[model samples]
Target: MRTTPLLVAAPLAVALALLPVMLVASGAQQVGLWSPWTAAPALATGVALAAVLLPRLDLPRLPWPSALLLLALCAGLGTWAALTHGEHLVVRRDPGAYATYALALARYGGVPLDPGLDVFGLPASDPWVRVGAAANYAVPGTGADGSATLLVSPQFLVGVPALLSGAWLVGGWSGLLVAPAVVAALALAAFAGLAAQLLGARWALLATALLGVSQPVVLVARQTFSEPFSLLYLLTAATLLVLAAASRGQRARLPALVAGLLLGAHLLVRIDAVRELVLLVPLVALLAGRRHPAAGPLAVGTLLTGVPAALATRWWDSPYVASVASSLGPLVAAGAVVTVLSAAALLLGRRVARRWDTTGVPRAAVRAAALLPAVAAATVALVGVGLASRPLWLVDSREPYLPGMEQFVGALQQQQGLPVDGLRTYAEDSVVWLVWWLGPVTVLLALVASVVLAAVGTRAVLSRQPLPRWLLPVVVGLAVTVLSLYRPAITPDHPWADRRYVTVTYPYLVLAATATLAWLVGTGRRGTRPAAAVLAAAMLLPTALATLPLATARTETGQVAAVGAVCAALEDAGPRPAVLAVGFRARVEWAPVVRARCGVPFVGIEEPSAPAGTTLGQVLGDAAATARAGGYAPVVLVGDLTSAQTVADATGVTLPPVVSLRTTEPERLLEERPLETREMTVDAWLAPLP
Candidate 1:
């Protein structure tokens, strides 16, 4: 097939050009690759130039080198955004758990949860928690005084690690710093590739550009988190699932295998992709229609290959999922209604009926079989909602220091009886629906436009218009995706279930929506560019507005203290006599570092819970074990005296006298040596009984 010259130029220039991420880390390595890659503004300028030039280039078919370069370009720019933008780039806490845990696992040749080996790093309050969840290796230097042992975390998806591997290949620190962006780039490529394939290159480019700047995605990409990267795997799976349905007479085993694997991998990272697996029925329907029997093999392969990580959730965390809230009803209903209505509209369109029939009996039968996949997908949504309603997955919402929020959570815990599964359903559900001004208005408009498009597409289909067979699925998939979003809210605090995790899917969803809409609108010949640009602009402006403050707060000069966190962790890994942690952020960034590098084990004695991932008692338990096992045996435990006193009162666990150390600095790291060792006890429970 002859390729577009613009496609050829886009990848080549992206690979060769400057990227925005280069402006942040010009080969500077923090804990990993993103810290390096040297965010040179020149690189960003070059990328910007390429971004402009490549699209306009009217080149022709390109070779493998060109394709490889294109992939590299996509990978690079994506990595840039991932690092410079995601996870505070400097270090945000959400996915910090993954990095710290991965580093911990990797440190020991990919050991998952070993008791003998001490986890090295700081800044991580519950490195083990993250290590176990991510199910990877290598404990990151948390830029803190302690580290978490990856007792079992290897379940994390390969997205971040794969990208980091690329950066690592580049050099030590440079690769590590570049890794996040690189991985994010790959993710972007997957996202863009699908977008372009389904929505046309123009829409794909516009969606991707917006994605590059969306604050939440940037935050995820900037750090070594996997959500953004994993989303690619998820999208890839969904795309493949669609393909599997259509390629009946062909050998889809390899592609189906890949899709299943991708789906499984995505589950490993987040455990939520299982919801999409419900579409197995639909997939099977397609396979069965051709007597292909590909469904059984496909199912077996996906389950067998993905089982280790998919089941890793239970292996790593306590039991079932546990979290504070279980209110996905709102998000699910909303997402479901949207999805169903959208799909129903598109499928019912007049155009679809005629063209669908023109495919002849064999093709028609194949298309009819698609109903199974759709039904299966719906089943998946139902199952997810069911699992979520019962509540599995451990979740910790910061409350103590947040004043009113503490009562809020307390009331929730009391009302819900503390869902021990720790499965934070709200994080999955409501966060998306939240009325944050973070996304582009185009997302909303896309939904509206998609309805009209569905109408038009249906008309064209019924009238036997020349829309490709491929398009019919794209429209259906888009509708299904939109419907899938309507699962129960994992986060009641946030609405729409459209939070950070799921927004990555928005590119595909929106693209499909727009594609159907545009197809229906007839892709007007003369003003297509202007119309698309206006639509893109409308959809994207809100995200830019939402991200302004975040970007400002993320500059190198501003995050010096965060830098100190890693330095402090490095200091602890050595033989530092005293390992102290300040706030939650301070502890998260520093403790893990100190634990890993200094080999000095310390506990974060701060607020009871919330944001830090666990109670102070939990950190104490791990520290006590680490210190005792390491033979250092903490001579003095440091923290807020008032909070320390509360621990003493709550659990009856005595505190060794605390003497405030306030010499040069204002905040103090109180000292309390352990008189004896024992199991930790806490007053407030985290969740329900497993």
Candidate 2:
């Protein structure tokens, strides 16, 4: 194979590149390998140069040189973004939970909800609600400090935290900073490899570039999000499936089984992947079965991996079940069931048609077999809708946080709205904003590519011959994309703009679009090549232009800056004092960060909503007593202005005036000033209790 060198070099290079991760994963005695600054840009430049120079050098005529370069681009840029532009401290409460999860994984090999380990260098003496979801609630019991240890949420799948833990092992707090971007690069590489095989090298390369610079990718890449890992798994499975479908005998069996393993493993990463799997696994099996007998092995492989993961979900302290029990949960379950049943019906119908063809039964009867499932599906959907029409559990479940159907209908009655407003409104607006991110040209080209792929797929399916090579990706991509639309808003507040919703599948959309263009602009053509090149350049120009801000943007800027300021203020205040966190939101977000970064044990004041809540005086007195008993000279009370007033009204102690700290000053110690900044203030006041 012309690409043999690339195939070999790609894996080897990735392995060599990820040596730091390998060492951490293997429990090497050493600490981190490369400082983010020292290693990231250097690697990025090297890989990028390889992309530009490797093909021109004419070394072994490696296939997919462009794709390799794109991989490098994504990996390099992602790493660079992380090292220079990343936030080391926990910003939002979610990342804090993951940090705790990573800490637990690093220290204990699994989550010990109440590990009592030193987080961010502070011992877990008095546990307060660490904020975010209830899943992170470590203890239902009260502690000696009169505060219960409401820990960080454990809502996420273990995959991301487990990966981040490796970073934790390698570089402590800082190492995990770039974990998301780096993992996103892994996803880009996986996609590039798959695209090179399915769509030519040029298309794969363009796809990689598009994904590398896109706003969504760039945004998610820099954060401690899980979608990148999920994307990596999905792309890997797709790659293996492509290989399995194309190969024969044992060659086919291995990839097929591995593909299934990866597919099943997806469940362990994110519960939502199950919706895609329900449609995808069966589709792959049917497609592969047509060419060869790989479906059985694939199914077996899936069972091998998926069963244990399902069992773990049931047994583990994961919030997946509880969260699912909410409205988003049933919607996903229904979608999965519908997708699987739909696929099964199609397969069963095909079999029935073939069997009846031999017996010479009425063609109508054969068609009815397939149509029966479709009818059943429609009936089920109607029943569901009818049930939903009344005050049903599913409809009722969604009301508290999001706009209910009644509200949606009222909005529609007032003004005609998007059919599924929650999902559609976000998705529609996000796409437009994404175009502004990737440019209108890229978005338009991608849409064209989707149409072209769809047309090609229709032709292949209608024909008697083997399905076109492009049809596989087309089918999978289209199925996944459609299923994505059905995704009931997990985050109603943010809706589709929350890039996590599309990160896994967005790369494929770009790949298909770029590949279609590549196919149109074959090297053999004269004017075609330049014209296609122009189109490709137009598609990428916006992405390139937009990359600077996206890559350099400060994620969770307000929160991180606040935490950094607090850390600075605490460190500057001589000896470490016991911190009293006064607000619910403050304690949830900042308390953990304070303890972790400053090694200060904190006493949290319960929110007014809590049972047996005391007046402001009791809250102040408790905090003072806790600090005094802990043998701390001064008690640092922190909260936003509103909470500060509550503290003032309840306390007799003459606390100092609020101090304003520069967010930039503390952050400079970790990396240079962020390329962009936000206007936010972190105010604090202190009191010394004799």
Candidate 3:
């Protein structure tokens, strides 16, 4: 009847064992590492590691019926996610960027990706044609030899791409698309394990089912989003940490070490993980002060993995690191301060306690410390009130971060019939945003639960009572959620921006709510138990209503077919190698696909200025001359009929539209919710140089 720690350890162990190998192989540019022949051994090693680590944890037992129900729930959710996965191949957003990164890694095994642009033989003086630096890609610097090698590196850290690369190698595009679903399922199972440990098995099932069906969870799971992987890693890590805290002696050491490693590995997945890691310094130190056997190993393991991964990210993806440096700087500073303070506390805590016991202290201060639990509970309620009431008084806005973002927001506002305020961020309504998807009942329940739990935790700490194993993870999760809700730091758009909640907030709230419900049912008077059950069932309505419509109707449908058509069109243009010069707009969407999928060198044409015809003409003329001299044909690809004609006039060739495919893209909603997609057309003209 007991579920072994294998359910949690297996996934974490495999991910941990494989991550290093994948990172090393990709960094070394070893294409063979992605092959089945080479990957099988690595997978075997992961299984072996899982087996070795499983025995170290003391996981709780669950009823067989409850376990079966949890399994069935995960299975159904996974199937639904895979069946309705989005086709986000076009490089329009983060999902597209992730897909392209995986494709390149799967094909070439590394980055600073060389698209073989040297064949174009273009002079460095040409300003119109850029060989690298497409959307979501960075041109770090020149090659080692000082030649003008246009090697482009993928933006963001390599963790998600490394995971996706394995999927790409297995099933190509399909595997890559479906990978998030598998991760989501694993994440749900991990959540179940954590919940079981914290709230017991029956409540765990309820919590898992509630979270698994939530809109944000479902939306992210159906595409190649990094949130799913983050969720899986974080939940699994928390589960392992719970098991470690429950155990005694050397048996706790391995799980604690692995838990710290997983927490550190989360940095590789998302740089923002620094926030969570920062909060852990004090928690780990407290455990160390308590003489918990796992504490030393956990701290050591965190540094062992985190320091190196952070440095590697800085080295390989400096541009991304630079972009977030504003926020990252403060977090790192806070982490440093916390670490030093925690160390000081661990070293001198008992001495200080002895001195404090002998020294006279103020009774008022003692009374204040005893009342801290009530203060914490009231603070939670106040925060909830402030967030929920923010929109009534505040209108959050900012100058556009990017050049065209203002205009883009304006257009979206107009489409949704909102007042035209391009600068408006709509961040003030974030609490309402949660209410829209989760419903007010669930939100209220979460708030009440948070208040109750915060009070309990403070009481436990102030009274020197033994803390539950779940206390650290829950506290950390609550802290992170509050911070995220305060400053989402994303473009305020529905569904697209909703991804912020998926990482920690939604799951934390769900767990809090379910745990509270379980408490009410178990501890309340007999007459109130039925009321708790009814309240539990009622919470599902709002979440289900919000999720079902979008879940049934897949967004970005036919995009995979559209991409295939474009690739085929390029192939039909010639048997000889060709340099594809993409027009500015098309380059954002197709440049990566052209280089990686079609296996052609891609050049992006800068936007034309005044005298557009002359500008286009000069750029195409130079491109054709350089391409031919290097023994390759030159072709121009544009996104629209007008751009096609512009290229035709520029090259003085009869350019015809070579590819036009229809598809659906997610609708951009301002204040309104997004439940469906709108039709879109992708057009491309390949003007082969005469």
| Clash numbers, per candidate | 175, 4, 0
Summing lDDT over every window of 10 consecutive residues in candidate 2, give the lowest-scoring window. Answer: 665-674
Question: Which candidate achieves the best TM-score against the true structure?
Answer: 3
**TM-score for candidate 1, residues paired by index:** 0.55
Candidate 1 yields a Cα-based lDDT of 0.42
Writing each residue's lDDT as its tens digit, candidate 2 over 1-690 gives 335446323432432233223222222211222233433454465456335433432112235556457557766866765764445344332455656555545554443233221211222442332333222444343333444544443556665665676677678656776777676777777777777776666677777777777655765666666677677767766766666666666666766675676667666667666666666655654554364556666777677666666665553444445545554465556757765775786678578658866987776755764455345435434432442233222222233323343454345334433343332223223343445556676656666566555555554543345655455555667566544533434432221144644555576667756776777776567688888888888888877776664455554444455555666666655465656666765565455455544556554555544554456566456555655555553454655666767666767565564445434211110101123444444456655543
- Measured by lDDT, the strongest candidate is 3
**TM-score per candidate:** 0.55, 0.71, 0.93
Error of 3 at 441 (Å): 1.4
Q: Which candidate, 1 or 3, has the higher TM-score?
A: 3
Clashing pairs in 3: none
Candidate 2: what lDDT? 0.54
RMSD of each: 13.8, 9.3, 2.8
Query: Model 3 compared with the native: what TM-score?
Result: 0.93
Candidate 3: tens digits of C-alpha lDDT, residues 403-438: 456787888888778888888878788888888788
- What shift in Å separates residue 650 of candidate 2 from its native position after superposition? 2.7
lDDT of each: 0.42, 0.54, 0.75
